[model samples]
Target: MEFDYVIVGGGSAGATLAARLSEDPGLSVCLIEAGGRGDGILVRIPAGAVAMLPGYGKINNWAFHTVPQPGLNGRRGYQPRGRALGGSSAINAMLYVRGQRQDYDGWADLGCEGWDWDSVLPWFRRAEGHEDGADAFHGGDGPLQVSHQKAPRPITRAFIAAGQELQLREREDFNTGDNEGIGLFQVTQFHDPARNGERCSAAAAYLHPVMGQRANLTVLTGARAQRILLEGRRATGVEIRRGRRVQQIRARREVILACGAFGSPQLLQLSGIGRPEDITPHGIEMRHELSGVGRNLQDHLDFILAWKTRDTDNFGIGLRGTGQLLRHLARWRRDGRSMAATPFAEGAAFFRSTPQVDRPDLQLHLVIAMVDDHARRLHLGHGYSCHVCVLRPHSRGQVSLASGDPLADPLIDPAYLSDRRDLDLLIAGARQARRLMLGAPLAPYRDRELHGMHDDMTDAEWERHIRARADTIYHPVGTCRMGVDEGAVVDPQLRVHGLQGLRVVDASVMPTLISGNTNAPTIMIAERAAAMILAAARGEDECAGHQAARAS
Candidate 1:
């Protein structure tokens, strides 16, 4: 098989890029995904997504575990990545957060040219079709739907009110650059009265509507890319396996890897483009010596604080909760407004861990449910949980090859809380969440603290609790960092170092983790990457046309 562009990992970036690039009538594009089309009801219904979270076998979640972290007393952290067409956007909580403006500016400062906040803001606007309509900071005509929570429970409201009582100003928009506020997170769903609110995943927004319509675009589901086929220094095709039948698909122009933070680097290393020591052990011939293929890993280390309540509104794993959910389903079907349409982590707060930070460094996702271990472990009684995470961590880890086998999972070490600074910041955020939960506004619903904790605990006690209970908020980035240095995997244009016809267009290219949910930022990255690719192709075409005219 052959195409003009071969995109690996038909997740968020690949789906968006395929949809955009194939708009040009002359280009032929192929997108290969290792999972299904992601059309399950659990993926569509916001609340039903609990079944797909990590340890649950519902979503095509590449439920990866990290190496033992010395900081967390040798406990391995869980990092789940979506394996379907929409990628994490299909399975994630659907929060439409763009992160702080300083994040992109910081990338530009780190040598990624044309990626400053001012430059990338347009791309963010271009990808979003906010329900709030077009404004100075939002776009209404874009493909991806961004809307507010349709039906939030009373517990969610109490959480927001409690934050406000603590002097946290309630802001209507978190996507308008400065996200320091307490509010309900706007999500990637369009509430249409005809069908209830549908999860507007990138596949739903970009791929599903256009795949069959475009003859030039081909999508291969259940296909895992094994390695990149290189002709000298240029990538020529990809060797992929589909149900034990291996095939080579050649690309005439480019090969793009949108396999996320874990998959992207793993693919590169499997293709023999990582550090020699890493590749040599597996008996694979090293094609290149890019030492940064799987370095600079980053993620938000989070801790969940739970409290018990008799309120049926706070969903739990019991008979009363089942009845409540059944009632919610009926309401959802009738008016397209119910708890079923709500992403459980509906309300949120963003604030600085310390006053010295230029932007808010800590974030909170106030869930109206007792979520434990990504919903893998369930609580028996009615309760709620507030998830607190450090927005930026000083600790950096990596993704490495566990074996040469493409079917095997990668070695992911986020090294959570490896830095003392990260622990301190997370501790501060946890204290803030604790205050908000115990505040007078939430007193009406509070039966008691479900877990072991006193309000007057010392910092040492808090630190111990944090180490024992902390986990990932599911945002990971920066393994294949974009920069113009020797250690960087990709250059300013996202092209892999010392390589041609290959590029990384996912979260892996981010020089650092953003301040909030990564789905929006990942989409923005695809938008910009697609623009750059199309422009370059147009230039090449123009030059070729001129040469043909001269020859004629």
Candidate 2:
């Protein structure tokens, strides 16, 4: 099989890019996904995330694990990625955050010319279909729907009130390019009558809508790409395995990698397109030499603080809570509004760890339910939890090959809290979060602290507590970073630095991790990348036309 564009991974970037690129009838695009079609009921309902997040069964999740980290007292952290069409966006809290303006400006400062806030803002707007109508900051006609929470729990409201009572300003919007306040997060969800209260995953917004309508677009689910078929350093196509069959799908124009931060780097190494050290150890011949393929891994190391709340307004596993949830689900099916529409993480805040910081260096999420170990641990009664994470950590890690086998999971080492500065910021952020939870606004619902934490705990005690429990908040980037530097895996246009007929359009291409959730930014990256790819193709066609005219 051959196509003008063969996009690997039917996740956020891949699905969006494939849909956009196939807009022109003349171009044929193929999207290859390793997992099944992600349109199941579990993926559409916002509350279904609780069942899939624990990583007990693979389900629609990759459920990858990181190597034991010294930073967290040698505990192997859980890294759950969505395996189905929408990728992590299908399983995420649906929080729509674009990060701070400085995040993009910082990319520009690092020599990524077209990625500055001014340049990338248009693409962000272009990908969003906001419920609030078109504004200077949001788009109204885009494919991805951004909506306000249909029915936020009272506990969630209390969490926001607590922040305000602690002197944090109430921000109605978090996507103003400067997110330095506390408020409820705008989520990627559908408010339309037909799909109201449903999770607007990337695939649901982009690919699924155009699935059978466009003959030019072909989506192949359950097709795992084994390696890139390279012809003398040029990516021509991909070799994939489906069931018992091994087939090669050729790309006439380009082969784009949208396998995300970890998968993208792993695929490159398996295809012999990485550094010699990463390629040769597994007896694979080097095809291209990019040392930065799997380096520069960054993620938000998160610590959670839970309390046994007396509030029955929050979620829990009790019989009464379960019965209430069933009723909510029934109501959701009728009018598309209830607890079933909750993103679980309803409240959000962005604040600076210190007063002197230029921008917010810490991010917090207040969940309506008690979450311990990414929801892997369960409690009996209703409760609330607060999560605090360092927005930009100084620590760095890498993704390397566990083996030469294409089916094996990559060796992930986030190296969380490796830097002393990261721990310090986290300690500060946790202290502030504790204060917010203990504020007067939440006193009515507040109960015993689950961790036995007190107001008089020293910084040393805080550090010890953090090291014992902190893990990832699921934001990972920079494995295949884009820049103008020699260490960059891709150029400013997202093309592989020293390779032809290939590009990477995903979170892996981020030069640095953003200040907030990464789902919105990942989609925005694909939106900008699609335009660049199409423009380049048009330029090539124009050049050829001129040459033919001259010859004639």
Candidate 3:
């Protein structure tokens, strides 16, 4: 089949492109996703991911496990990437944060033109339909429906109190231009605009509610893109597998890969476009020797120590519990409100690892309910937990071919904490977590031990404990980094360095992982990349939505 554009993955980036490109009606877009539709019971419920991440209800997660990291005390990690529509954003805890401006400026500094925070600000605004209405730094009518928590959890209130005691300024809206304080984030909520509202993801924002009637857009789920079809030097389309059949799609315009950080790099390697040395052993012919295709992989690694408390009412009925479930079905319980939509989580604030900087280097995610060892073995035993993940990680890793077969598992090395700096920062986060627990506001919840924490533990014991339990905060990026350097897989325009008719527009292309959760930034990248792709397709000067349009 031939298409104007054959998007390889129907995740965050693909959904945006399909919606935007098909707006012209002149452009035909085919989005192929390996997973099924995004309408699963788990995918729709915003706070229902505790059920989805563990166990096997495949709505959008790829459920890929990583090779044991030598740095992580030789322990393997399970990486749940989005495999369905809307991608990981569909399955993630929807915290809508546009990371520090310096994160983007750092990209431009790396020679990726037009990617500075200033240049991409409009695109960020363009993708947001903020619930707080709009401000000079936000957009009101964009496709994405972003809003604050509807029923901010009591624990969330406690978090702000703790921050207050620490003199950390409370930011009602973290999406604003500056992120120099601690506060609740304005999430991408398609349902409600505040408090304990239902979680809204990108698929909910851009694609859902619009998928049923768009004729120019064709969404194909369970379609695994095997490789990009190359006619000479240009990418013509993609070859995919659906069920027992293999289909070929020819693209007249371009092929955009939005399989996220993991799948994107895996697809690039399977298509023979990754590092040459990594490809040769797999017995594949190299189409392009992009050394950085799966390099510079990064994510926030963290582990939260919980203390059992007398608060058994932490779990709510809107999303869980047998009794509340009945009341939920009995009526429109929220009465069309988000803040009181059954308390999901209450504790979240950013704090600096050190007092050197005003903005937080580590973020604290405090789930009122007990979450232990991968959200498994629920502490129905009445406990509260707070997760502190480093906002920035210095360690790097990659995804490479483990075998020649496309179906074979790729070698994923997240190399978490391999850098001594990363180890130190994480230790700082732990000490910070301890400080918060020991702080005045949380003293009431301190009836039990937190992580068996004691002042008597030596530095070596802390490092050992840190190495044993550290896991990803689920933000992964930089596999197909955007830069002008030789190792760069994509240019600042998100164009593959040496490939034609091909571009990677997911988290994979991030030169550095943003300071918070990666979903918002991934969507931001798609919005910006869409404009860039549209501009390049028209041969227009880098003006207006051309990504570089706002560059000073």
The 10 consecutive residues of candidate 1 with the worst lDDT sum are 543-552
Q: Tell me the lDDT of model 1 at 113.
A: 86
What are the clashing pairs of model 1?
none
The candidate that wins on TM-score is 2
Ranking by lDDT: 2, 1, 3
Winner by lDDT: 2
Q: Weakest 10 consecutive residues, lDDT, candidate 2?
A: 543-552
Error of 2 at 187 (Å): 0.3
lDDT of 3 by residue, 176-262 (tens): 546766667666665542422455666666777668677878888878788888877789999998889998988999999988788
Give me the overall lDDT of model 2. 0.91
- The C-alpha lDDT values of all candidates are 0.87, 0.91, 0.74
Q: Which is better, 2 or 3, measured by lDDT?
A: 2
- Mind giving the per-residue lDDT tens digits that candidate 2 earns over 238-308? 99999989999999999999999999999999999888998899988899999899999999999999988
Q: After superposition, how far is residue 282 of candidate 3 from its true place, in Å?
A: 1.5
Q: Give me the runs in candidate 3 sitting further than 4 Å from their true place.
A: 57-59, 191-196, 316-345, 357-359, 546-552
Give the runs in model 1 whose Cα sits over 4 Å from its true position.
193-195, 540-552
